[model samples]
Target: MQTNHDHSDVTVRRDGHIAIVELARPPYNYFDETLIGHLVAVFEQLDDDASCRAIVLASQGKAFCAGADFSGGPTDPQMPRRLYRHAVRLFATRKPIVAAVHGPAIGGGAGLALVADFRVTCEAARFAVNFNRLGIHPGFGLSVTLPRLVGPQQAAMLLFTGKRIDGRKAVEIGLADVLAPDGEVLAHAVALAHDIAASAPLALMSTRATLRQGLADAVLAAVDHEASEQEWQVRTADFAEGVAATAARREAVFTGK
Candidate 1:
């Protein structure tokens, strides 16, 4: 049996005990406030449905998520704060999530993938924490999630360098749990979700809740610090240089000024 739901930028479908939540933007799916809100709503609904024991989070795009689309949004200072407010809600979800990371997951995009309990990726997948490269502090709770996943040393390396690593390297560093063959990432993620779903649902949720206890609060706290830092960094000359260099696909020349 199957059931489907369509949101503005996301799709939710159920196949027996596994719920499939897919980001619908094509090419490079750059998340913004609306997309994140839709995801939070979908996860909340799935959490209430006893039939959904687990979820496979995938995307219809060359990049799982490139990051935020900063070019078009309202330039209001409160925009990112509003977005992170919803992001914290995503971390509060109850069900287990397996993220199918087929391509680049950079900056906040990487944070989205980290929201999952497990990540399945292919060699084609690339992961990076690029906030420093953008002359901003990491957001989406990456300051908490990245270090928790990869250990502080490895997380610091990725954050400081803003270098991208392929799926194999990501797994080696504990950033990804499973590495699937190219083109089979989503399939592997769904299979993993099904395996989780096959377990007794009540026990699974109970275990998951215990394991993830205090995580949402930690993320919320980290976001507050991150947002505070980014608030000042966004006003720096280095930020302008970084943005221009990124757009031109070149290395940034940052001056401490």
Candidate 2:
């Protein structure tokens, strides 16, 4: 038996003990506060459902998530705070999540992937925490999550330089747990989730709780600082130049302002 739910750009479907939650905005699933909120709601529901032991997080898109849609230029100045506020709820979820990243997961998208307990990716997958490149401090709790996965040195390198890394490099740096072929990322992720789901449910939840203790609180603290820094950074001239340069596909020339 399968159960499906439609929540605008997000979809949740159950397959036995495994739940597959997908982001439905194809080509590039750029998220906003509403999208994050929908995801959190789905996770919360799945948490209450005893049948959902583990979750596979996938996307129908060229990029698993390419971060926020900046094509409309700067969004509401308060948007980052609101978006991160919703995002913190993801960390409070109870079940394990395996993210299938088939393409670029950039900026806040990278933060979204890190919210999962594990990540599955392919050679085609690209990961980047590019807030610095965009002339803003990293948000979505990446400062906490990225370092927790890849160590502070590697996390700092990625965050400070805003460099994009492929799946192999991601695995090497501990950003991803498993590697799959280009088209099979989601399959592998689901398989991993199934393995986790096969374990004794109570023990699994207990072990996971111990392993992830205090993580939600850490993300909460991180997002607060991230949001505050981003608020001021967004008002800088360098931020404007960064956005313009990215849209133009040119190198940004930032002046300290």
Using lDDT as the measure, the top candidate is 2
Top TM-score hit: 2
- Relative to the unseen true structure, what is the C-alpha lDDT of residue 93 in candidate 2, on a scale of 0 to 100? 89
lDDT of 2 by residue, 1-257 (tens): 56576697998887789999999888899998888989989999989999899999999979999999877776677889889989988998899999999999999999999999999999889999988888899999999999999899999999999999999999988999999998999989989999999999999999999999999999999998988888888888988888899889899999976
TM-score of 1: 0.96
- Residue 124 lDDT in candidate 1: 95
Residue 236 CA error for candidate 1 (Å)? Answer: 1.7
Candidate 2 Cα outliers beyond 4 Å, as residue runs: 1-3
Cα deviation of 139 in candidate 1 (Å)?
0.7
Clashing pairs in 2: none
